[model samples]
Target: MMSDCGLDYIELLQQEVDRTSAKLLYLRNEEEPEEAPPPRHTPHTCSAPRRLAISPGLGGKPLTPPFTENLRRLLFGRTVRVFNFDWRKSFFHFREPNSELSYALQVDQGGARAVQMVIQARIIKHLLFSQQGGSEGRSLLSLTELGPPEQQGALAAALSDSLWLAGQEESATVTMVTEDDSPKPPSEYRLDLLTEKMHTFVFNRKEELSSFLLDHIHCFQEEGGHGVVLFLYSLVCSRTIDRIREDLDSSTAHLLQRRLGNFVCSQALLNLLLTGRATPHVCNGTQAPGGGAAPLDPPLQGVLSRGDIGYLHWSREQMDRDRLLQVGSMLKTPRFPVWLCCINSTYSVLFSLTRSLLSDWRTEHQFQLFYYNGQNSQNSTARLTIDTHSHHWEAPSVDPGVDLEKRFPSLEMTIRTKWEGASINWGGIPPFY
Candidate 1:
């Protein structure tokens, strides 16, 4: 009986394995073959050979010294600002190579203010080989496609390597303002220290640091205060992910995802600065987003809806501010509250100003606002109060009458004539007295 029972158990185990294998085979057969990717199109076919030469304005005379120094600093510097530009139609147009390229670099030399440097260069080599891809051509080096982990790793490796290279470059006799009293560390040491601090900062405070960095990014731009505000506004003005997802359109969702991903990555870089390991600086060529390269997924693809996006923005803003306050309070620094309040006031003023401008535009165009309580006759008697004061006035016909001021008004004229035809059932309502 014991031998028979053991044999039966072995048989059952064999049967289960066979069943699973058959199911796996059936699923594999049912799967459709992946379609072959379309052939990659070459945008520019011109094979003209261009000499390797730095632009005149990149650094006054002798391209070798300043060019190498600045490039090294950009790649390995402790505090670096990651810029994202639209580059729709400018000399630095990523789509097409022009005669010249222009960019502005700013470095905070451990002083009260930042040092501004402008560099205009010509593109000599559009492509380079990377360890991951042999002879693979790329328009720009993008951290977004790399994903967060790989991007951070690559940046760390690059900074380490660049610092070593910077040390090898011949030193110049020309002297500028040296802020550090101690002899400047070899380029490699400085780079290592900067990168180490950044890693520490990012590891500690992920999202909060990113948001704070984005808020103060304007101070790093070369276009000065005027363009910085506009630039930042454009960066944050894209439609939310939820709205894009609700549309159920693949292309649009991809576009939004790409943009959102880029914004998130840019913010992540800013978060790296709060570690106080190094002062922040900006690099010229690295200024543009997607910098002539197409996103693997466009901004609109796989994006969240408008409501969700708004919530995310609000949540991030609140959390970041709260974290800053907590950290500042712990440090017992008086400057923290003042700085936080100032930034809050600036954002509030900007939002109000923009809203007013948009409202004026809507008024000129005869646009209107429509509201609804989303209640039926069964719930009509329920006391409801709508706040119109917070909303912008668009259509003159829709007025907030004195009756609405009462605690329990007989009628609430919240819906406009436009919405009445679509969202409301006017036939059921009593005729106006």
Candidate 2:
């Protein structure tokens, strides 16, 4: 027994050494390169390309996003107990084997959900865009497809890329917040760039905040750096509140709202993360009133153009009681076959391997769709078989007592937003919300 215990201890020590060595090497090799040329597709590597690169080493020292206690209270509702988050203890931390799967983000928390949501978005981008062939590149990967470390690296790349993009948004200066002369409660604190006491980091035209972001990818990725909050600050600083207000009129588009002692992102805020603009509605371009003597209720701001990622929203409660707002084609059919979904007010993701699932109707007949809810509770990626042509329930004569709206699952409703009359099959697995 003593000899066996000794052997096990030695093996464990060796494993630890190997893991540490591998991590150190990965960190050094993946440092962001300057004006990186388009990366060569190596399924083995996760290097950032030119658009995604954040050049390091040129700057005097590594930059961490200057988040302070007061600022954390103001934005995130509370500060993390540690100055830097411990990856081992938190659900937010990415680990081996589990990292490659559809990892869950503790969404019902403070603004931190933004980090998880954005990470998921980036992973989706990496998986969809990273496929090999001309025809095959249009495909998407399932939860278990990529290796653990590669997916983790992809998360690093994606988080950095999002921060860089947020910085690149057209704003006059990058806004940084500090305590005002007259202190206020955390609940009352807000981001107001025009206020006299605010501190602004001036990154004038052409120069972007991403220059700082590229170097500090780990700050957001590994250290629990409140990346999404930091990027939100960068974006708001760039666009300014005045411009954001105009994007959705002065009245609507509230970026954050109070929820269960913490705050969560509003629709406009979610759109801003997905796209650069904080338009409230999910439609194509700005929808204005028809040329008639109608009251000027302000034009609706929406997705100005197609983005690399897309969005979808549906609520059983919203559909049953409130005004039924339909999702437009712009978000319903994106340039890619992936979407960040809000179903019954909970966030989940739905994607397809086939790119032509939208543009060409013929491809929709019987294609597979996979769903990821970011919960460890999910037994498997919900593989849904959509039969657009074979669905017989489209006719009104089917049954009035069936409560048509409740009869269809929310996921099916979400898919029907893109594929209008399609029927969904859960493949013998009982349908879940």
Off by over 4 Å in 1: 1-84, 87-337, 340-433
lDDT of 2 by residue, 1-433 (tens): 5797898787556545534543443243234232343222111111111222223323222212233333443333333211111111122344334444533333323345554665676566665664345234453334455554555556545544444455454333333222232222233222121121223455443334435434444434432233344445555645555556656654353566555433566667777677666778776787774455268666767777776567787788888785456666777676777788877767777878777766787787789988877665665668888887876646664568877667777878877867768888888987875
Score residue 218 of candidate 1 by CA lDDT. Answer: 27
Query: What are the candidates' C-alpha RMSDs?
Result: 26.8, 13.2
C-alpha RMSD (angstroms) for model 2: 13.2
Off by over 4 Å in 2: 1-92, 95-111, 131-148, 167-215, 237-242, 288-294, 393-400
Evaluate model 2: give its lDDT. 0.53
TM-score of 1: 0.17
TM-score for each prediction?
0.17, 0.65
- Backbone clashes for every candidate come to 24, 3
RMSD of 1: 26.8
